[model samples]
Target: MLFEKTYGIDLGSSSVKVYSMIRNKSYIEKNMIAAKGRKIIAVGNEAYEMFEKAPSNISVSSPMAFGMIANLELQEIVLYSMMRKIDKILGIGSVMYFAVPLDMTAIEKRAYYQVANGHWLRKNRVYMVEAPIADAIAMGVDLENNEGSMVVNIGAQSTNFSIITGGRIIISKKIPIGGRQMNEAVCSEVRKRYNLQIGTRTGKRLKLVMGRLADQHKQARKVVGIDSVSGLPREEVISAYVVNAGIMNCVNEIGAQMKVFLERIPPQIAYHIAKEGIFLTGGSTRIPHIDTYLASYTGYSFNLSDLYETSSVTGLEKIIHDRELRKWAQPITQRKL
Candidate 1:
């Protein structure tokens, strides 16, 4: 017999996160193993622990690149592993709902739907959901009206800006600025100035510990990285001021994209957005001062969706429970040839 709960998978670049409802609350988990080489040595928290600690033979890599599936085979591997992992916890088969970027073409979207089905590996009963739309639906944005709501998901490799009107993607933009870009830019900056090199894991810690986009007035934290001049291990007292500089590059790029989104809306439609402004999600938005930066730039009040990290995944709950949303979602998996 089939299980009753509907599960959602947010197939992310660096890791895969799953969210299912358990007793009305969202049950979520993620794997840190970046897919590289022939095998995924670690998944989820174990992989997260191995991120910087792992040996060279095991290089952690993100299976997805630029908001699309770059490695189909590894994706299947990790996905199947994750599905089985979930099955172990639930003790039953699940109806799956997976989300993809808004700008994904018809064929590309279908490919993800197929991945959700796990056809090659033998999983089934898959449903496809758009990332942006699911995010809005979970955020409680009005779906029935043509007034429209914009969701900007700042992820690891790419930023997705989608406008959903009547619960569908009418216009959207996918830009190549995300969490990874920020880390790389910081690494580049430190290397150029200090001649110091660091790993993504180190860069990630720097970005999170003191990552900021606000002014120099705020209290800053001193962080360590490779020293440029000595070529020896070094530590520098980094002010949040210093880190903010690296983060703003991406924030500015996002602002520019938001401008494009603003232009795409007609004057009448734009008026409605003026009332609601834009909603921000994804892992990057969690950075300090990002929300304030966008608000200051656009002159419009911007709000961040609750659970910005799990918004897309948990949002599918609203999608499946409602008939209208289910209509927008097509079952691409488990189809007979």
Candidate 2:
């Protein structure tokens, strides 16, 4: 029961994915926590089920905010709860490989190290890997080559853009527009145009179901929401066009940032990006025609990862065994502790 093992932990704002080297499989779950007073009642998928639908006494939320650790205590609780569900904790010297945001500040990076080294983890064995690099590896890009490639991850709370060459990140940037913002925009637009106030979950459902390119299929769905005037629940027919328009602002923002990002890179790298096409990953990439929409705006083709959401963890799994990939790992510094 005290077997030594290494875990690849991708703790994102929307979900937590873990890749176990010993088990050779991955665990994926929504990164949610439901608390009643000071006590945590649930975590992961179970807590996600209660989001936006929990009783007044129970608070359901993600411990992370804007891709960084916001509530240290809550994050620790959620991390421990999840680890326990997977296997028994053996305490000290249990190696862990963590996928970290490339643009995070020193303090933010410290938060991740601290959480992993907290009581239940192996403080000295915690290793860090850049999230975007891991994603690129998972996508089958040869980071060791002299050629360059660009990777864009559209997460729940933030989007990360990285320019990579020679197995290292040359330039990386993060924007604060993601799935949550898109859902909020959808809710706001629906309320403005239809006088219907919808829940976060409902808005998200509509975005995924109807958010598509201009020429994509036009379908309609019945959406239930509270009427602004009556404050009573009512049903309204919402078309894909309306939903598409609602989330377009977010899509355009991402495109704008991409244009800016490309402008800053060297011409040689930019040329590589053009030939390779920008790689897209993360849960938000699943939105219908998102790549096409981004391509139209940027004037370059786009490539999407088949396992966008779990790409980082999958790459982490690969790193544990591949000596060349393991060279990218950065050991936790003593100064941070």
Candidate 3:
């Protein structure tokens, strides 16, 4: 079914991303939902609190893995509940325009289609679009102008790089390294250095507050984690040098991939990216000097978006209003995905 109103979803690893736009206006937004044993016990701000604060009875886990729906039943239940809650909260419904990774196959795309379309109330008709294309649009890369631009979106599961020209997505792919990997690397380092075991929360804090690229950000952050020996909590301060060393390995991986993609890009479009430079999005973009690190290796300038978190949704909001975008996108019914 065609929808005059649209709801855009990101369905990220750490969050259930959704936004609604009526004929007049829309907001860029999301909810952090926590899951355990296939049940969604909490959602939104409550779920976010479970990150470092939940009791042992709660095990907060990411529902979306590697940019795909890892648990369909949990995901559907989560979506169904959210839809019902949103309906009550907003008193409006619309079709869903969702973003999936560029690397997902036709089959995976079909699965999203199936779940989104199958629901009874707000059984959504999904319009599938790669994240970066929306990123380009959000970055205001004019497709008709064809001024080339690239976007590097670093998130929990994977880092994605996509090249866009004239408002069309040209090449896009995913690298395995991401925020979770950085968190794990920090945990490994803390274990080796201080004999402390940290949870995902502590590791993520290190990534944000203290994590740096190798030879960048010389300061360190004091970290707290579980005491490996005493089975109690422990605290220790570590230099950015150590944290940097751990996460820099992942940063280097992205740089290497960027160089490879740059080499493959035709000189013509490559010029545009080199001129307009690369755009950075996703929550991971906030890590200190990530752009600087990328620049050091690639020697290509990088641009930062003001609305990094909301840009993708804002871009899709624009797309939803475009007849051309609707025509190019295949309407994915919930049954097909």
Candidate 4:
């Protein structure tokens, strides 16, 4: 008999995270693909390298957008490519657990099933696990308890606010705002203030370096970009204040929405959440003092998870290995269209 393998996969918009139960290791790669007119070129981190710098003939793009699978075909290709790299044996009878957004429609949920049942792994089994549930598990939240827990995941193109109680999700919402929007806001601020045209990647670097909310210490970083005024290449020193200004715009909006979301919760559940505070985990939450910043808006403390982008996959790892936690992962059955 052949040994079966199990994997936990989080197909995030910015990157793909996979955890191999057999290997007991996690893998992360940029969820990008580079192609030249239907011809395959590169995938994963290699493709990300050519993102802003690739020639006109070579197009680099992500198959996922806003935490959803935007292009099913390309998405399948990317997943298969990454799986091959992780393990050479694309053996039958393997099991896969995918962490998916809660707000996805039936059709959207089916897309995940399609990808798993696609050409590469037709004989494998697929399970669907809500992203927030996995995140909470990774954060060491006691989901089996009656206490309510709130989780916020800020990804590349979207932010998910979810409430979980008694091992089930109570309410969840996905907003089309996240790290991408923050990066754009940074670029926009730079253009308006210094007449410099910087790419989103540059803006991301600036955010990582200087994005602060509670602590507004002064800082600066030199960046190269196109001069908006002269249409020529130029280098400029950008202040942390400008970067913070742009980031706060998005953060404030999320906070305001979070406030409204919390208002609708029942008093009893709200009470538990108040005691436990909010469970925050995601890539965009990496900004310094962001937890403190959000605390001010919602009037609640936050427990920040250091797992960052890999929280969901890490949680899935536990679910796959532990029989008790496996109850949260449901098999994705085919739905008639």
Please provide, for model 3 over 185-303, each residue's C-alpha lDDT reduced to its tens digit, 9 standing for 90 to 100. Answer: 87888788889888777788777877755446568777777888998987888777767776887788888998998898889988878888788887677777778888989999988
The RMSD (Cα, Å) of candidate 1 is 2.9
Model 1 bad stretches (over 4 Å) = 1-5, 21-39, 89-93, 119-123, 215-222, 333-337
Model 2 RMSD, rounded to 1 decimal: 1.9
Query: What range of 10 consecutive residues in model 2 has the weakest lDDT sum?
Result: 116-125
State the C-alpha lDDT per candidate. Answer: 0.71, 0.86, 0.72, 0.92
Off by over 4 Å in 3: 1-4, 23-40, 51-59, 89-93, 119-122, 212-221, 322-328, 334-337
- Candidate 2 residues 1-337, lDDT tens each? 3577788999999998888777788998888999999888888899999998999999999989977888877887788888887877545666788898876677887788778876655454788999998998899888877588999999998999999887789899999999999999999888988999998899999998888866768689998999999999999998777788778989999999999989999998899899989999998888977898899999988998889789999989999879878988888865865
Alpha-carbon TM-score of each model against the true structure: 0.87, 0.95, 0.85, 0.97
Tens digits of per-residue lDDT for model 1, 1-337: 4447667778887667676554444544444455457555776656667776677778865567887887666677677777666555544345778887765576676567557555444454677777887788777787777576778888888888887777577888888999989988777666665567777766677788878667445655555666666767777655555556777877888898788678878887678777887788888888877888898887767778757768887777777666777875667643422
Q: Can you list the residue pairs that collide in candidate 2?
A: none
Compare the candidates by TM-score and give the number of the best one.
Answer: 4
lDDT of 4 at 246: 97
Best to worst by lDDT, what's the order? 4, 2, 3, 1
Model 4: residue 29 alpha-carbon error in angstroms: 0.4
* Candidate 1 accuracy as TM-score: 0.87
Q: Residue 150, candidate 2: how far off, in angstroms?
A: 0.7
Selected candidate, larger TM-score, 2 vs 3 = 2
Show model 4 residue runs off by greater than 4 Å. 335-337
